[model samples]
Target: MTETRKQLLQELAAKNGTPLFVVDHEVLRNNFKEFREKLPDVQPYFAVKANSNPEIIKTMFDLGSSFDVASIYEFKLIYKNIETWPDKERQDFIWDKIIYANTIKPFKVLTKLNPYKILVTFDNIEELKKIKQRAPDVGLILRIRVPNTGSMVELSSKFGAHPGEAVDLIAEAIGMGLDVEGISFHVGSQCNNFDNYLQGLNFTHSILKEVALRNFEIGFTDKEGKKKKVLDIGGGFPVKYTPDVKSFSALAKKLNLEIKRLFGKDNIQVIAEPGRFMVATACTLVTKIIGKSIRDGKTCYYLDDGVYHTFSGQVYDHQHYPLHAFKDGELKLCATFGPTCDAFDTISLADELPEDLQIDDLLYAENIGAYTLASATDFNGFPVAKVAHINRENI
Candidate 1:
């Protein structure tokens, strides 16, 4: 952090009050541009579940980015942006720019999504049946279980069908008079093992080949009048949260080479759901120390935000955002806790901060824009962080 940045944060905190979340749209645009430049062939669907702030969604919309929504509420958030357009234009935008990426959706959601006729993902037979009966108009993408090893969050156990059963499920969907548009897979969230992606691509290739052998015609025709198959290489684009984490540029290079080597000649529309990569580093959280004490000869500081609020990402996303003090002093091991009564609200017991820091002093955490506020709760009568936008002007 620079002195200018620290001064700005302090000013923002003074004006907006503590437990403030600052979103920098300029950073958001740069992240989007980086993703596009690195992987030119793949279209990005900003995962709405990552941080469904309407302003963030609008920014992504303004950048011409597609969306991957997990629920009907999220679907409507994207729809809110285009509701004023003509009916044809609205529907076209929905088809082209939105995907209900949640593999398991409820019957009511299926019936609700049927009118849009957009693309959706499914992994099991029950979901397929529900989609066939309740939402037959939508396009389908089969999600196969791939290696989630060494990922920050493992998703294969809960989502994705076994790769071995992928083709059979596709065949069954087609037999039921439903359109199986393509195949999709998620290596995992914040994936560290790049080989997991390679294996996922190989699985998709083999499944598509088998589907071809079975003479099952999948995919839809694009405006170019060419038949194109949808190859949704689902979200797992790693973000460099720390120095040890691998770079997305390296992964993109590998993906470009492997995608071309395996399906170079195929008419495939490759897409990805990038949730954390887009917003993690684009925002920062500033909180105020409400109390100060000493425990076991170690300094303890309590903030207005905790695990149930702005710092919830620490508990849910398995990420650690080391808090920093604006005042310069010798650093020592300290404890940080949230405003909540439960000890479970502890942010960190090993946080390093100056021992002389006093109450009402400001501390901020960077790279906390992704999952923090999205999952926050107003537990113990403590309100979630107030969000303030910076660099929000159109670029």
Candidate 2:
């Protein structure tokens, strides 16, 4: 961490109290800009499920971001934000700035979302039937299953259809009188293996050609009625949470080369659903030791936040945050536990912590902005960590 970032985190903790999330808009803007610069032809739709703090959303909106929403609650949040702007300024966002990326949704939610005419994703025939019954007017994107070989979270188990089934699903949607506008797939979250994406792209190319050969009018069309296929390579773009992971620029270069080789660069309109990459490195979680003791001959510390709070990513996303202790002393092995009553609320099973650390001593975690707080709960009546936005205008 930079001295400036450390100072900001200390100041935020002093003012907002411990167990706070310090978000820097400058980092957020730089991350987004970096992705766009490397992949010039791709449109990035910020995935709202990563971190739904209104401040983050506002910063992204000001930078002309489109969104990837997964639920009715997320939809309402983005819709209401766009509603706050003037009509002329909001037209860009209202028309085509969002995609409902969830493959499964309740019938009532689908019915309620029909009037918006937003784009949505589905992976099966049953989902197509539900959409046909409730919201046939909306644009449809088929979600296909791809390999999650090196991803921390393998989404294929819960989402996506096999490529063999995608053609039939799209045909069924077309037969039901729905607008089949695109195809999508996730390489999984926190995926470092680029081969997963390469395989997915190859499959997508084959499917597009197959659709074309069959004379199926899939995907959106231009004014001249030319088919404009939307290729949504869903987000899993990893960040530098650890030294071993590949950098975004390196991954982008490889991806750019593959895209050019396969589709001749920008032949098909491309989009990405980036959730963790956009905000993962932008926010730091600051927590303080509330109690301490020796357990099994190792120093054990209890913190104000844990599994039901900001560190929820450990249990949910299989992530281990990089921890930094502020106190100065010889290092000792320590186990950090959360404030929750559950024993599973362990934050770190083993950490190299300062030996002189005591109650109220501050410790921080880096690159925790993504899946951390988004799924946090009030279990044991512990409140969620407060968020403080910094470096806004500097962006």
TM-score of each: 0.99, 0.95
lDDT of 1: 0.93
Worst 10 residues of 2 by lDDT: 87-96
TM-score, model 1 to reference: 0.99
Query: Candidate 2 residues 1-395, lDDT tens each?
Result: 77777887888899999899889899999999998899898888999999999889988878878899999999988898767787765654554688999999999999988877588999988899999999988889998999999998899999998999878888888889999988899999999998999988988988887887877888776546676778899999998778899888888998898878888843477889999999999989999999999888888899999988999998888888856887668877789999988899988867888867889989999889999999899899989999888888855
Candidate 1 per-residue lDDT over residues 86-153, each given as its tens digit: 99998789888999999989899999999996999999999988998899999999999999999998
lDDT for model 2 comes to: 0.87
* Candidate number of the best lDDT: 1
- As a whole number from 0 to 100, the lDDT of residue 14 in candidate 1 is 94
| Global lDDT scores for all candidate models | 0.93, 0.87
Segments of candidate 1 deviating more than 4 angstroms: none
Q: CA lDDT of 93 in candidate 1?
A: 93
